[model samples]
Target: MGRAGDVAVGVVFGGSRVDDGQIAARQFLLELWHRDQQRLARVLLFHRLPITLEEMALQISMARRSRLAFLSALIACWFGASAFTYQLALPGRKLVFPTDHYSHPDFKTEWWYYTGHLTSASGKPYGYQVTFFRFGLRDKQDVKSQPLFTDLYMAHFALSDIAAKKFTFRERIQRGIGDKAGAATDRYLVWNENWRVSGAGNDHRIVVSDRGTALDLNLKSRKAPALHGDNGHSQKGEGEGRASYYYSLTRLQTDGELTVAGKTEKVSGLSWMDHEFGSNQLRDDQVGWDWFSLQLDNNSEVMLYMMRRKDGSIDLHSSGTLIDKNGATKHLTKQDYRIEVRERWKSPKSGAHYPIKWRVAIPSESVELEITPAFAEQELITNRSTRVTYWEGAVQVAGTARGAPIKGKGYVEMTGYAGKLNI
Candidate 1:
């Protein structure tokens, strides 16, 4: 559900009609729900298989096709296990809140995502994100009698040094089977050994230091609840149960040390955190999403996303948030935004082209700015969630703020651009 399909494509191939393209994409999505997104398929299932989707197709590249197929197998194993139970479809009518936050086991999956842009002691930029995903095996809470029957908690953390042109990444998968790795509710703690993101009281800390690389972050927010529109009913497509509960904590006064390569330095900047969960988040006709959360130089922030259909048009309800410095929030519906990919990168792995550079236009304020990622190799390949890979990287924001020189830091998450993210 990450590819909001807002970015433009140089050429829409798969089908002559947008509907045809969407149908194909949706088919690809549905098939993957069992194998890829659900984490039902594991590495052992295909470790013996040598097929890597490296061919070229008129639709997407062979790498994507193979990835989609491989991902489907992985999700099937992860979700179809005996540990989780699901509600399948449920009513999503309430505004999602923190108290409402946690694993929606009834649903296929959920993730708590945290990303920050920080500056090192000597004036260097370092960015990183820590995401903890919980997948309910059978939608049934784990029974205490069984030792191996437990849901899976997958953690992915990465560090990007903008000027260094390199990345520090690590991924871990632990079956909540026991206490090797687990998430707690009464207090904030999710960890597996030395790597953990924990907090209680009013403060949060993400500590994951391994093999000399780590992200020791301290988070404090300046804004209240920066919620997504429809009263937290984030519609993905016009269909039954095609929505999610999405919310964000924008503009966190970030202070911590980003350790990468081999050094740890004190850093301070702005950080953003997003927590979203729901049952059946994808529509039959939707492909993916293009999500961007930016902290503008004027002290105001914009959180915008485009949910795209297979047919190339946008889902009118794939909205965003506009928060002012004073902590007030504005609902930005589908009409007030226009985000496009001005440049692209053809990943050597999948050979599927991804829009790496973008020009975002917000007509309401007569604003036009270019947003681009600091690196294109931020695609992560994790076995815990499946072998599916996607782009999640730090971005450099540059443009004029009301005819003045202003720059900022943020992150751009592009999905479906390379192919369906499966997750």
Candidate 2:
């Protein structure tokens, strides 16, 4: 037998001739099988292997004499040597701009998030959020069909009417069915129906219209993308691949139009953009996370996330990044900063008790801040899309930076209050 055939035999029969490549492939396939049998079947069937049913039956018959060998050979034949592999987020993988901003289908999960505080021409204040998500269903290499079923696309659009004391949001979910919904691999364009975000270089545009609420905004980065945790590999839990390639455009000059309740007004503000992608992130014991993105008036920014475990302790791998006015970044470990909950809010819809107020202090940076929600009712019950009940809202920042009085606006996201987040 040739080398490929020999490797296949070793993988199926546990032969002594098994090479390192065969062993790795065997482990990967087994892991995939254990995670989701239905997903594995989809992966295998879509690969379109040339093995005929008669050939497969012969192989199965030969292995039937040994039950262990039969199971191994069956998996090996179904998975095939050309089985696709998803890419994992690992250390030292440098991110390249524009290219990295585009869709990364090799990773299992990715998101493009934009949040900002906007002020209208009429002096009315508003907070807006538009997010696009891509969840890989199967690797592109495994698909031989059109209208690629390789990914599922979802989006969320929300507006916080501070004056009206109201929060309105919309959700969308769709398969990559034609051009109706998909993210481009060669460019930075992602959309779900009419809601879309596209850009080139540091300039971007976002548009979303649902019902009478809409946001047509343009964003230009005021700073370069800040790499979080060891050059964009943000660790979440205690294991290999328990991390994500994370970065943020900490400051984006935003301007456009905002329409609410049939009133359209020109708006301008500062925005934050985060793009993260990875194959695996959360561990089974990790319940969820509390994420903060603060933009201070001093032109500096702080991004922190605390991964909460089932045992009610924070994971040591939870870390953050500090961006200075000049676009420089400094990584912060859990021990470097302190976050204390000052108050909580119980959602009337989901009953999730979320920490609505926080006192964040970073002694090394000489920063102390109190974050409070602009309004208490920004929680989203995303049953129509992500099916996740979480609180994502605009917040007011107050306190001191380097002993100088400072204040700003930001967004806080709290998940797992209703239930453990699946992703």
Candidate 3:
């Protein structure tokens, strides 16, 4: 693995330096997180929703009468915390390297997401996603107890077998206590037990195993990191702080071994990586989003998210980034593109309807694409962590760009369809 800087000696939050008080504050925050977990469980049991407990907790604002108290406390622990405790993702912030590839403990939320399309030597096509999320319980400086760790780590790994029309997924959550799980700030290393993404610079390795399925991949960037929306400040809402520092490795050459159905196969393909960190990224009126990451055969990629409002209109702040063959990026605003759902699939497991097919049009760029899922049932019912049921799967793209026919594979993520993704 390539090392960036020294292992930040001690705990650091966001870009802030850490002290003893910060350690105590993080410990206190963990206590809050633990209590909130229990309270959230009670709220879910009391409300008895078809949704996952994690989703129920996030949707606590809509809880029934009996669970209001517990929900309120949980919300307080998250949104009502002292402002001094955490750093907000604001405009004009410069994102630094290697360190930025790791974790930002000072930010309330951060995620490293990897999605790819692969084919076995036998030509069996597949799609996979591996994501690691770090949720700050409290800033180290805000903790009152000297705990060894402060952040909570959660990971999701999924594999999509296209021809078989099957999708398998697994999730894990860890406290990061005693090295059980955590991320490195001085380098690019994030892990939850054995599942991890570690690298130096733009080269990385991803390893995940569950049940009879596994992926051991080496990823090398083929292009520079593409910063989205105003140089990495991707806005989601109308006001300030409703944004995130988002960047994507639009193209990564992937080579690895994948074990599926008890058979291990060597696979090579293209992958995409997105790393984002921010706090207070959404407005109260926003409910959910439809995000697309498309890598076309034309040596170009597009990343777009359409944020939906409670009133059913699309948020104007919803934007995208387009990466050219040479890694040049162009910012795309709401007016630059349009997304239309072509089909909906109802999940028998959750009784929720989700859009399974879509049409994306970027007229200004002469881009129009029809996206279809590798399978209709790629919904992840994350009961272990994040508790929200969302559809995130690999997709096949067929459309025209610049008046030329093009085809490729990509990934699509739909949130707030099963339950409100308050987080």
Candidate 2 structure lDDT: 0.80
> Could you give candidate 1's per-residue lDDT for residues 1-423 as a string of tens digits?
101122111111111234655545544544443343234334312332211122111235455556655544533433333543344433445643444443454465667788888888999877888888765544433222121223456778888878886777788765443244555543456666567766543357878877888878888867666767666666676776676667787777889886666777889888888877666777767777878888887888888888777888888868878788886878877888778778888878667677888888777766678897888888776644445566788988888756777677788776666556443
lDDT of each: 0.64, 0.80, 0.79
lDDT minimum window of 10 residues, candidate 1: 6-15
Summarize candidate 3's per-residue lDDT along 298-373 as a digit string, tens digits: 8999999999898889999999988999999999999999999999999999988998999999998898999999
Deviation (Å) of 86 in candidate 2: 1.2
Q: What is the lDDT of residue 9 in candidate 2?
A: 30
TM value for model 2? 0.80
TM-score of 3: 0.82
Q: Best-fitting candidate, measured by TM-score?
A: 3
Clashes of each: 38, 0, 11
Point out where model 1 deviates above 4 Å.
Answer: 1-98, 101-106, 139-150, 401-405
Question: What tens-digit string does per-residue lDDT give for candidate 2 at 1-423?
Answer: 122112233323223466687667655654443454343334333332322323233444344325434344544443445545678899989999988998887788999999999999999888988999887754333322111134667899989988887999999876553345777666788888778998999789999999999999999999999999999999999889999999999999999999988889999999999999998899999989999999999999999999999999999998989999999999999999999999988889998899989999999989999999999999989876777898899999999988999999999999998999876
- Residue pairs clashing, model 2: none
TM-score of each: 0.74, 0.80, 0.82
Clashes of 3: 11
What lDDT score is found at residue 95 in candidate 2? 96
